[model samples]
Target: MSIVTTAQAVPSRLFAIYAALFESETGEIKDRIEAWATPPSLSGRGADDDGESTTTLFNNTLQEARRIGLVEDIDDKLRLTADARGGGKKVRDSEVYFLDYMRRTLFDPARALETQQSGFMIALTWFLSSSPLRPMNFSEPPQVGMRAQIGDHAPKTELTSLNRYQNFLYWARYLGFATIVGGRDADDQNARRVIPDPVRAIEGALPAVFAEGNDLPIEQFLTRLSGIFPVFEKGSVREDYEAMLLIPVPDPGQRLSITTSIALQRLADRQRIALTSLADAPTRILDFGSREGRVSHVALRA
Candidate 1:
């Protein structure tokens, strides 16, 4: 798509495409390519051929990305470009810039609402809730704990995924939702150590702990009670099982004495904010085209 080199608001299509192509060296055909490639693929799930489902908002966003210059066209193949660089601040390509724009516009707003409801603690909880794997997979058939491969769907344990989780934790602590209960003071140091017990403990309990609505105060909710969970050591679900045999609750937190009514009210407020962000964040697809035929098309968003 042709983009006017102007300083007006960045086109959403260009922004989406740029975001998708920011770090990648290649191009893609559709913006929602990741979603299309994900489990329960969104290809044929859409109504039209080439998986273009008007009903599928992502498919529609991909079309919009095509309209922006972030995607280049050669024959049937589409190419994308990286963010524009060399300003005092780096100038990202349209797609990369678009992704950042989306984050700032939509995601940021949702987070703002969430913070208002429950400070920043809710952000960490929401981030964990959004982890790639089913946090409560242990409750499922075959009863496993954080397996590398669970049937067909694989858990994303890559550094990129880990970085995303760590970023959330970093931001949480920076904002005060998390306090360094243990470990060193350096930013990455605490992340590297065992101080962030809440992440693992909460992951272990989330599928069941928050399964049903319970009235609980924001500060005292036992989302990560240690005694009620099983810990998964790195690379060892078997070790997790053995460990569970040794200690039922490996990292339980102090219990609060607040009445259920007060806790329930706060929980309700936080949940409303969390659910609202989930509902509002636009999951648009971002496609881009590249000038180089070798790295022709790229997709991002969703």
Candidate 2:
């Protein structure tokens, strides 16, 4: 089972464990983190550790970390990986950590191969490759009935239950590749659905994509974007992960996703960027059903 199967391995807790360890230059013994992070719900319940006689919440999560190579268990202590150690030394930003180190590890081709492709990676690729006409709402609720959807797209992609799909949602949302939208009632999650919205992530990455320049070609923008967020269309993550699926993921056309198109349009409207199509230039069209649009170049505006 991957980290998704381990309920205690949610992103917040995972980062908590990671941050605690990151703050420690030297490796920390297992007990220190266990005592601090074990919720009161499972504080003294060793038996609740899924049959591990010597385990608690932290122990179970630590095992999950070890399986994914996030943490090394050596001489009964936990140490963050070398790659995870670098960056924001004094600050240890969770967003940066998750987007960079955690994301890279979770979807790593070799590691994911051994784990049979984590639920998050599988579900994400399906959305990335889905046509704009298809439902991108891959949530955890059965009322929406996404299990059959996955079956239709990739019959071999086995999501054990709604719990696994929920785990996928947690990771997807935390990473900013997806967002929750449109709900009549807060209690009714089925009333709402997760959509492929990477606006926040794109906004955060604006500086990197634009760099010193004020504007760049649409194709260049996508190239830089796919490098940072490899799960997006034409990204390396999709290339690597799609091999595992029995059915080839459907082609959603070569244009940007409907969600991404909306994100760009939102940015354009807010004057964060300018989208234009030159009279004679290579152009990439935004996938908006409401109207036909083409963006050959983008200008980053202050």
Q: Which numbered prediction scores highest in lDDT against the true structure?
A: 2
Best by TM-score: 2
Residue 233 lDDT, candidate 1, scale 0-100: 18
Show where candidate 1 strays beyond 4 Å. Answer: 1-17, 29-41, 46-55, 75-77, 81-96, 99-302
lDDT score, candidate 1, position 258 = 20
TM-score for every candidate vs. truth?
0.21, 0.77
Q: What TM-score would you give candidate 2 relative to the actual structure?
A: 0.77
What are the clash counts of all predictions, listed in order? 40, 0
lDDT of 2 by residue, 13-52 (tens): 6777788887776778887777677655656656553453
Worst 10 residues of 1 by lDDT: 292-301
- Which lDDT tens digits does candidate 1 get at residues 117-167? 111222222222222212211112221322322222222221123333343
Candidate 1, residue 135: CA error in Å? Answer: 38
Residue 240 lDDT in model 1? 29
Q: Which stretches of candidate 2 lie over 4 Å from their true place?
A: 39-56, 87-95, 107-119, 129-158, 181-190, 237-254
